[model samples]
Target: MKVAVFSDVQAVLPALEAVIEHIEAWHPDMVVMAGDLVNRGPDSGGCLALFDAMRREQGWLPVYGNHEVWVLRCGEEAPASEGERDIRRFTDLAWQQVADQAERLHGWPDHLCLHPPDADAWLHVTHGTMAGNRDGITPGRSDESLAGKLPQGVALFVSGHTHRAHQRRTQGMDVVNVGSVGSPFDGDVRGSYGRFTWRGGRWHTELVRFPYDRERAARDFETSGFLDQGGPLARIVYLEWERAELLIAGWRERYQDAVLRGEITLESSVERYLRTIT
Candidate 1:
């Protein structure tokens, strides 16, 4: 059996468009989205529409990501506290672009397992670890660390949250990260995913990378209200798409603590963080 997985396509419609063309050409027996199909970029609503359409026509399985959890959280009743309200106010408009689809998230599965016909080996897939979506599995983690993320009795464990593409083996099972489709943190700016083929009694995995219209994606950031309305942090997100690197990690590393402690406002922190990156 052949399988393909996509993760972290954070609402970049063009990238999502390019990825679908490629995956369909591969003609895998199964197609799965590991999560984050919406949020964090422009066209969240459009991306969700395409994904739902794919599910209807092509049988793509949806696995909810942390971002989906986040948007779903946002769709709930507004926070009462001014502090909490301030936080959501920044990005609320960006998320509200897809408020209609937020209800659909209620039906999404947490994770999925794939079993090839009559085969003992199967694939376990999730947006993140069993611990939660915020927990990440990277290429450089130790066997012990990766082992903790694995679900028992699966030939292959697949996840994508770091937006970094990598694969590692621990305890006789393969741990593969299919990487990011819409936004990649890894230096390589290409769209990425995982291709798995059942051959010779084992799952053969490959990290597939391809270039898409980065220019158009960048323009989407400017035109889609994600940059203007996605909150103070949205600028940095656009920069990541331009740089194909992580800015949010650095921003959070330096100012997140300060913001959490109320030492600085979210707006102030974003200003300070951008000064260094820009």
Candidate 2:
């Protein structure tokens, strides 16, 4: 049996399309979305619909990621103050545009277990880890640290959220990080995914990169209302795509506290950070 795992598509339609075309060529028996499949890019609604269609027509499975949780929380929670109400209103509008079927993200299980025929061990799949979705399994973590991220007795653990693909073995278990199909934190811009094959009573894995129309994806950020309506942080989000690298993390470290405390406006912080980069 052949299996394909995709994660962090993050609502870039072209990237997901490229991934789908590649998966079709490979023709895996099972296709899984490791999650964060929506938000943080242009056309979150379109992405959600596309995945939903794939699941309905072709049996792709989805597991929850923290971004899914974030979008839901953004849409569902009531604001606590007038300033927060404005933030809530802004977030809610964006959320509503894509969240008509938002429950689908909420409905997903945190992880999945694949039991191939006549195989004694199962392959476990998740957006992050059994531990949680944030700060998911990293490739270079120490054996002890990595072991803490997994559940014992599983033959294989598959995850994403780091946006850097890798495969390693530790504590007698195989671990694979499928990386990002979109919005990769790694410097490479190409879409990435994982392929797994079950043969001869064991599993083999590979991380593959699928090149997509990233130019079109970058343009979509402005045209699709994501950056315009996705709020102040959207600026940094678009910058991440433009550079094909991470920057908001450093920005966040410097300004998150100030932004939260009302000392610095989010727009000011984002602009301040961008000037240094630009």
Q: Which one wins on TM-score? A: 1
List lDDT for all candidates, in order: 0.83, 0.82
Worst 10 residues of 2 by lDDT: 82-91
How well is each residue in 1-278 modelled by candidate 2, as lDDT tens digits?
Answer: 89999999988899998999999899999999998887778877888889999999999999888878877888777766534443334346447757678766667888899878887688999988777988576666777876567877778889998888888888788899999998777788888999999888788889998789988897888787777776777777778877778787788788776776778777787789888888
Clashes of each: 0, 0
Candidate 1 lDDT, 70-132, residue by residue in tens: 777777767655445555553476467778766656788888997878797979999888888
Which runs of model 1 end up more than 4 angstroms from their true locations?
80-83, 89-91
Pairs of residues at least 3 apart in sequence or in different chains that clash in candidate 2: none
Question: How do all models score by TM-score?
Answer: 0.94, 0.93
